[model samples]
Each structure stands twice: as C-alpha cells, then as structure tokens.
Target: MSDSSGMPMTFTTGQMTSLYSLAWTPSTTGGYAGTCIFLIVLAALSRLLLAYRHLIEQKWHDRAMNRRYIMVSGQNETDRERRIIGGGGEKAEEAVLTSKGLDERVKVVRSARSNVQGIPWRLSTDLPRAGLFTLNAGLAYLLMLAVMTLNVGYFLSVLAGLFVGELAVGRYAGIDDNHH
Candidate 1:
C-alpha cells in the first residue's frame, strides 16, 4: 500500500492497530519507529566504516614505514638481528633470531593498531559517548512513534518519552560529544 509520504507502506500504524486493540494511527505519527530503526543501523554502519577507514590508512602508513626502515636501516640493525634470524646463516640460530625480531616488530604493530570494532570502541573510546548524545536527542522521536502507534491520549508524555529514550540510547552508546 501507499502512504501519505508517497512510499510503499509495510506494516503501518493502522494495520498494527487493527492487530492490537487500543491502537490507532494518525497523520502526525508518520511511521517514525521503523525509520528510526533504520537510522540506528545506519549510524552503526557509519561508525564501522569510519573505523575501517582509519585502520586501512594506518596499515598503509605502517607498510610504508616498514619498507623504508628495511631499506635505510637494514644494515645497521643487522648486527643486533644476527643472534635472532638468519644471523650468520646458522639455520636454527637464525630461526630463533627471526622469531625474536618479529616479536619486537609485533610490539610496534600493536602500538599502531586501534580498536576498530563497535563493542570495544564504544566501551573504551569517545565514539560511544558521542553516539549517546545523539541517542538522547532521539528519545522524543521514538516515544512519538510508540505513542502514535498506541494511540495513547497523553501526547506530551509520549513525545517526552520518545525523545528521552532516543537521547538515553545515544548517551549510553557514548556517541555524544557533550557527554564527555
């Protein structure tokens, strides 16, 4: 079916109300709940994409640094690496040396790495705090949808809840810049 917004309607406020007693739809509601969910998913994806961009750039920079180091300082570090890998061509000794050298390199790699995933990034970094702030602002939005869906008489409370819930979620996600 088509909605007032000129979009193909799915399960709508009316359809939903028909299914559940004491529910109704109005022109003001405007299918906000479903759209809000989509928006949340979009926000999550945006965060992931941004994290990936940073990680990819970091990897590229690291590769360049490593190559430059190998070309410019290879000989200088050779004496130290002798006991680690391929040092003096003693196969076993060289293997040990190589492993040890890699261990040191691993530290550098770790230092350059960052938490790109959501759970960690949200919990430990500023990203979630920022998200939280946005979510807070969204609270009124959700309440309006839910209220409009429920056809509850208290419009103001419904609006407040909607905004509060949205803002709370954003704050909890720690995506708000003002939060920190």
Candidate 2:
C-alpha cells in the first residue's frame, strides 16, 4: 500500500530487540542521507522540547507553592514537618527556626509535595497548560519508539538529543544547583 504521497507504507509487528531499523521516513526526501539527517534533527528538537516542558513544569510548581496551594492526601502538617526535619543531620533545630515562620515553611513544603503528586492528574485535567505536559510525555514515548527502531544511528541521535536537551535546560532548571 502507498500513502497519499505515493510512498509505500510499511508496518511490522515483529519483536524489536535491537536498536537498528530503517522505518523512519523523512517528509522531504527518501534518500538515506536526507532522511537520516532529518530524523536526527527532529529527534534532537523533540527531546529539547521535552526538556523545556520540564523546566516549565518546575516553574509552575514553584509558582503554585508561592500561591500556597496544597494537594497532599492523607498527610497532616505534623507528617509534613517530620518529613522535612527528619532528614536534618545536626542542625535540625536550626533548620526549624529560619527567617520564615514555621507555618509558612510548612505550607510551602506541603504545596511542593502536592504539586509533585498532582502533576500527572493536573496535566490531564488542566487545559492549555496541560498541552505542555502531554507534549512532553508524547515526545518521551516517541523517543522510546525511535529507540525500538534498533538503528544504531537513530539510537545515537536520540541519546545526543537528550544530552543536548539537558545541557540546554540544565542551568535554567537549576538541575546542578544544591537545593538545600
């Protein structure tokens, strides 16, 4: 069978246990050089967009905390406080008596936990903004599928994309910064 573009359509159900396949077809050209380069660039951008979505979500979560939004389930203030201070090495007491009021700190921590847990649900339910989360997830799944193609070059391309994406968002996401 051929697609509307007159390109022969192909599908396979065989087990994919490797990372090498010639399944991807570029829209522009069928030549290996053109298609491979296109797929590589597309994969890289998709991964970058995924990373950018994560950065956006992180910022949103922080904003939600600032708004004092809490979504914890079956956890009370004491539980939250314990979770926060229990990991205190030696300055647990000092950690408790910071500039911010105890209640305020507890609220922030609770909100953060809530944001973490509710992210999936919120992404599906919250309109417009949910698009980012959905896109991130879709890109992740697509990247996985691309890996299943088992093509060494495709696998390398996906890996390169992920690495580049991380580098692009690392500073903005504060991934390497100590958050204590």
The numbered model that scores best in lDDT is 2
User: Which candidate's TM-score is highest?
Assistant: 2
TM-score for model 2? 0.44
Report lDDT (Cα) of residue 122, candidate 2: 57
Task: Report how far residue 177 has shifted in candidate 1, in Å.
Answer: 12
Estimate, for each residue in 1-180, the C-alpha lDDT of model 2 and write its tens digit: 546954334433223222224354433323544544555666666656655655666777765554433223356756543332223334332334345643323222333456456454454335646786577567667777766555555566677765665566554544542211
lDDT of 2 at 102: 39
Task: Please identify model 2 stretches exceeding 4 Å from their true place.
Answer: 1-30, 68-125, 173-180
Error of 1 at 136 (Å): 22
Candidate 1 lDDT by residue in tens digits, 16-83: 23212234322344443543443354444434333443454455444433321112123455543221
